[model samples]
Target: MKKSFKLFLFTLLFAYQFSAGQNQKKIDHQTLTWIRYYNVLPLTEKWALHSEFDNRSFVNPIHENLFVIRIQGRYRTSKIIELGGGFAYFNVNTQNPDADPDYSIPEYRTQQDITFINDIAKITFHNRFQLEERFIQKADKNGLLDEFSFAYRFRYRLQSTFTLWEKEQNSLKGTISDEILFNYGKDNKRNTFDQNRIYAALRYHFTPNLGLELGYLKNFQRRASGVDFYDRDIIRFTVYHRINRKF
Candidate 1:
């Protein structure tokens, strides 16, 4: 009877191992199909600085050309907390001959983020909160309109990374993240303006600190000053590099 019991226990263990292995194989296949890279540089160390420029154009003939410059800085306060701030400048130039001349807008923001890392899989969960103010200069608007207007914005983003294959000189990473935004204050037109953005990307890294990212972005914005809602589909290509960090 004791010999029979041992045989049964061995069979059960073998079956459990086989099932777990199959599940892991399925997960690997699904997650590794596409690799993703992030434009927001990873904070692997105590301090980081990053900057990039983006240009966008629309199919509409009456619209304007859009160019954006972004600068970001981050500092780690602790194992789980981080503080950072950045500013962005936007330039919009009209294409139509009947339209007004070029105009520029500047936006400044400060933010804090917290992260929790899991040791086993090395997965990290990041939470971010921020505040921003924007200034717009237009030739048509009067005196007070030229002044900077204050608007408060709140955002939440969740992202994760998984290592597919790591060799001596090359690696692939897959990233998935989503963000939601809310705007408040006087310039937000009585707290009615809001925006929602979502992105999915794939990245290939030739080195640990340098890589390229290609992604799709969906943006929805409601302007309090306008009657229509603006929806945009954006294809983004970004280059990422981290300097002065050890991971």
Candidate 2:
């Protein structure tokens, strides 16, 4: 176990070290802000529907970038494991709002994910593996937009949540998470290293089914130029809720 852990740490360090040393002169920096909403509707003890939305904007000047919505059907197999399938739709635009010939894109994706939860010592940990099939739109030579390109990506996330205080349905918690993504498929011509996200948040559980979270996230992304990268800093606000009835 110790050897495997050391190997994982070594790989992570090497990857980041390599990325940090690449295209130092071409790195782009951006600030972003987002508000996210999450919901869960439990139909039974083992089945649930989940949905989420995100409104994203670039900060430091305040302009819109994208909006996204996703829906999922989730099945809980046990206390420690769950599986889900979802679809997401995205309306995305480039940074400029008034640019002539607006470059707005509509995107679609289907996703599957497996979630695992466990506790080590006193800290609670959650791990997720997600795979996505993406269909992206592009403007054809005739100047008509068409969706004809496909892409695939795999993502993994590890998160730990620690309780600060708890009393009945009210509590405070802190969480930290790291996620990495790799992309493939026919349409993906850029770097294989897609993105990495690091996040930290504080959450307040006001009721058994509702919570609010405020967080900070840093995103590192490989650009289409293949060598250049961007560092995006995001300020996040999220509302999460669950709806369930006695069954």
Assess each prediction's global lDDT (C-alpha) against the native. Answer: 0.55, 0.82
Best by TM-score: 2
| Per-residue lDDT of candidate 2, residues 1-247 (tens digit) | 3432443365467458867678554777889888999999998989999999999998766678899999999999998899999999998776433332455678899999998877766677777889999887876434436456788999888778888999998999899877888899766677678888879999999997899999999888887558788788889999999985888
RMSD of each: 14.3, 2.6
Measure candidate 2: CA RMSD: 2.6
Cα lDDT over the full model 1: 0.55
In model 1, pairs of residues that clash are 35-202, 35-203, 36-174, 36-201, 36-202, 36-203
lDDT of 1 by residue, 148-239 (tens): 66666776555556666779968876765555567767667643536555567777888877888787776555545534444566666777
| Index of the highest-lDDT prediction | 2
TM per prediction: 0.67, 0.90
Q: Output the TM-score of candidate 1.
A: 0.67
